[model samples]
Target: MPFSHAFHPATDHTRLGKLFYDAVEPASFPAHILRYRNNRAAATVGMDTLTDEEWIDHFGRFTPLPGSLPHPLALRYHGHQFRQYNPDLGDGRGFLFAQLRDDKGRLLDLGTKGSGRTPWSRGGDGRLTLKGGVREILAASMLEALGVETSRALSLIETGENLERHDEPSPTRSAVLVRLSHSHIRIGTFQRLAANAETDAIGQLVAYVLETYYPQLGVPAEGEAALTLFKAVCQNVARVGAQWMAAGFVHGVLNTDNIAITGESFDYGPWRFLPRFDQNFTAAYFDQTGLYSYGRQPGALLWNLARLAECLLEFCSHEALTGALSDFPELYETALDAAWCRRLGVMQENPEADRAFRHAVTLFMETSGIPFHCLPFDWYGGGISAQRALASDRAHFYNDPSFSDARKALEARRPLPGLSLDHPYFAGGVPCNMLITTVEDLWTSLNDRNDWQALDRKLAEIDLMADALGTRESLSD
Candidate 1:
């Protein structure tokens, strides 16, 4: 295969040594049927030219990428699952398959889901239901289009296996998913080292993360390096949490393992986009207490970051680490305000004005019982689209007396410079949404009749939405 000039392979993770992960083999599948390929993501790493056969071989068969990891590595880590510390947690059914640099020379990892069993499998079948894979693809696509910092679902291939899952009907189809992410090193990675009292390993991991992910910070004094990295990670994670809030997403699981040190959202299990503004809404059926609910995500993330800080305590003082953690609320508030402005396509004013606007928008949405997507879709350009929005079918909801504050807020802000409202996506009757019902229907069409039209059409609509939102352009920057 001809790898493009932009394709730069690196085995940087290996530098962390065997103590952080274990070499593993991918399971040999009965069949390799390609389901989805993220050509855009592939293009970033210069693999978009691969034929279907080659794509299947590399992603499904787990063939090593040229100049990348020769074999898979099931990473070692421990995480707090729903506030309960679980020492046995790790990559139970996934592995870091390959690592390479994108066009901008940033490291990226090709990680697998349901590729095989490993020491962490714990007697469970190391397989992903086809329905689960479909959900993840949709989740990633929708989140990315909405300008959320998330992993890209690189490739999904049916693996011709019958799997029994409690969550779904028996004898369901199986698949393997490959996701492209900035990094797979999780807070749990550091937790594992801390748990074992491997202070030296923790220091090594801290140095590796700084050099690989935060090189801009440069070499800090030995005492300040860990604190510096913690602060950066805090900022990144806070931005992610704020983005989720702006997108009205509920990540059902906020486990330490799922919270990547890089702050990129990945491992979409039981995720949901809000149909309406409901703070108590949760995606996972198992979340009885709503620990990671839509309204509480910011707090949940801060809690997880504290866990990461605990691991870094060996290198930094408690007061310094706590102060770094203290920055999360302000950082999240700032990011959330900016994210809302971006989504609304309005120019941001002072912090007080921005905060008031956001609060007004939230108050109206919660009290009016309007669909979550409708508000942003209707008022995308703020006051600039007021006439268009009021003329639409959803205008009745906007006319309510409760909308007065939000209306005033919108009228006070100007549309972002060069933000055109003429995009066909805005003119459409309905906005692109990923409600649970829509997802289930899409899956049903594919599973019962092998009809991919609905799924394909939805993806195309999502792309149009992205174009209108300028999320694709923002991501490129």
Candidate 2:
């Protein structure tokens, strides 16, 4: 099979002695049952060549792949966990396994979770619960279908180990999850360099990022590259934050370390889709202060962007960095409008129409008193026809007076080109959603009967939704 090694021997992160990562090996597990495999993502990188056994060996047993990273690299970094800065945080449970390019030739990283222990394990056992792996698969699938730029859970394997945890049942099952994403670099990656005052290393990292990911930016003047990279990252982060809002996703933990440099969402832990339009909705149980609530996702991401700007300050002037950081709010609002329009399944008419439509949608959601997920389902083809929505369970809510102006705004636009009003999803009265109860119910069947048919069915439904509405990349255009 033809494979492009985008980040291995072709381009190593050349900040030698900066301690950006550490070499680690995966744990030997008793079982290597392939629980899930993403052939859609695999085919993009020519990894579909791997047979089922090869997939298990490579991802489950952690056997080194030919021409891939010879040793797993446990990346080092620091993050502000729950608003408190912690210097001793890094990839304790996983490492980068390989770097390959997708069919579009975009660089992609194959990273692991619950694979094994690393230097950053910090006395805790570096393991992942089987239930955790299952939840991530569902989260990624649902997010992708909803047009959120997110990592795909490429492969999941039951590792056949009993793990004890404070959260879930003790001596529970164990598994390893591998995800495909654009990049594993994080805001915390730059924070470590800034903390060490490693100006030279920071410059080198900036150059690497530009050449590897943002080549379109081209080479800038000597001292200007860092600022340029910071600005681009800020824009990308803002765009992703906007998508999260449009998707009704509360990312639970918005730590700097969880913020992907490529602006793709990954590392799902306690994420939740909103039941309704509540701004205070939070997913993490430990979040006593509601720091990273549903409405605060944008602010949390901006905070992370500021940390990245602080890192660039070592190489660029403070004024330049702040200028880049200041662009986030406006950039986020613009991106949010675009994303919301895409989710609404309509072409953005103009700046005024776009702004008005977005506001109308928000107002409708705030006052509708319906489950948040219903809007996307009932209006699958852009809410162009209120008659169709009225036929379903949403009829009473759609009749509410507050939705009058919102329905008018949607009626002004035609259906998004190429979307069929007759898609089967539109006819299905119940919209597909990954609510907490639904996810737990799916797991319950698995736990009781060791049956995975329901999980498989949910994925099929999600794929159909993605095809009907289009992925994030397709809709944005």
Candidate 3:
């Protein structure tokens, strides 16, 4: 069925008071419908709250609210699907309610997913499941609290309809996710228009993104201009991975459609944080190949960025885009190292420190053999951050076997995580964190520690300790 009004911009009238008669409708799902109005969170944005009845009036039955207006314009975008170009993709079942400036001057767009069908539905059902909305809310909130930059969930309302979901139990309830984001332009958006030979549209979207999210890029011609945008993207990609690594998060799916051009974590789906270290861990139960394993996050991100670079082929010379792509490795490596340092609370950046950091990572993974979640993984990955890092990966000042050349490199720093290691808030158990277990396991077969994977686990322990110690220091300071 065609939509009643396609891409109609409406300033959620329920924003001020109850959405009286004919404003909302029952959720459109087959499962349990759960309605979560935008009152409480909306208040934070300095918006008014509506009564329960008003909420129902606005969302329960499909009707325009009092203050609602056709959006001044249809949100414009294009992107790739999988690896294919898709030029005609827009809000198939969603619309931008309004654009507002947050306290920090960040342009925040309030968007509704599953409100109804739009010009972009592409002849498919445009519905959202309650469970899916719940998942995204938890994913975004948890990641943000872990210090990852992410989109925020403003509200999730049940439209009083039962939804059929493919991944969950049959006949799930329906819900709507009204999310706030810095930008929604995605890599797929670029690929879609580019594939249609709509260079002009791609340019318009690129310019919009620059003016909206990365005004600093200034939308110059390809070459250094393209490189600048690419560089910005690479930095964001690297930094996002660093944050993910620090917290042991694994994004189950990282398709071109999922990677946000703005660099903020967007489109939360099947995400998990490791409780124990395991390079082969994944979030999706069906990811049998582990194509997006926990350890391969950095590589996957780089690949996604490369796809984005490919989209810019028309605006910039192939050489320019390639040059920008090249920066990804150097930039990602540095950010990776820096993230380890920050997570460990290391005070300096050096190859030696990074090596020890890698070793620490290796140790934790080999010993625990645990999935991405477990008690030990939670503490350090959570905030057991010690502000101190090793002076260098070469800490063997004393000729002690326990403090061997490798151990020396790892433990050469003084003040140890300096002080955070001693704090209770950051401490989980006295010992046996995933990283510690890995190191101790290595100790049992000390010689076997030479194995790359085994050593990686041990290094993970060192890094975890550093994080704990660093966290303890912050409390002390």
- Model number with the top lDDT: 1
Question: What C-alpha lDDT does candidate 1 achieve relative to the native structure?
Answer: 0.92
Query: How many residue pairs clash (N, CA or C atoms closer than 3 angstroms) in each of the candidate models, in the order given?
Result: 0, 0, 76
Whichever of 1 and 2 has more lDDT, that candidate is: 1
Candidate 2's C-alpha runs over 4 A off are: 1-11, 14-18, 472-477
Model 3: C-alpha RMSD to truth?
11.7
Candidate order (lDDT): 1, 2, 3
Model 3 lDDT tens row, 1-477: 111222222342223222110222223443323334434335534443455554444443433443344332234455544444456666666665555554445566666677766556787566776656756665665555445667777666665566676776657656778777766667776666666677776566666566667876665665345556667878887887777776677888777767777777877666766656777888778777787788888777888888888778887788877777777777767766665555443444477667566565445444635343332222242222222112212212222243244333334433223344444434444332332243235434422333434433433443455444443224222
Give lDDT tens digits, candidate 2, residues 1-477: 433332222225423443678878888898988999998778777777678988888899878767667778888888878778888888899998877766666778889999888889888788889899999999999988888888999999998999999987788899999999888888888888888887777787888888888988988988789888888888888988898898899999999999988788999999999989899999999998899999999999988888888788768898888888888899999999988888878888777778888999888898776888888677755656567888888888878888899878887776778877677777677788889999899998887789888889989988877777877457334
Residue 162, candidate 3: how far off, in angstroms?
A: 1.4
Worst lDDT run of 10 residues, candidate 1, spans 1-10
lDDT (Cα, 0-100) at 359 in candidate 1: 93
10 residues in a row with least lDDT, candidate 2: 2-11
Best by TM-score: 1
Query: Relative to the true structure, how large is the alpha-carbon lDDT of every model?
Result: 0.92, 0.83, 0.56
Write candidate 1's Cα lDDT for 296-414 as tens digits.
Answer: 99999999999999999879999999999888999999999999998888999999999999999988998898999888988987998899889888999988888999999997889
Off by over 4 Å in 1: none
Candidate achieving higher TM-score, 2 or 3: 2
TM for every model, in the order presented, reads 0.99, 0.96, 0.69
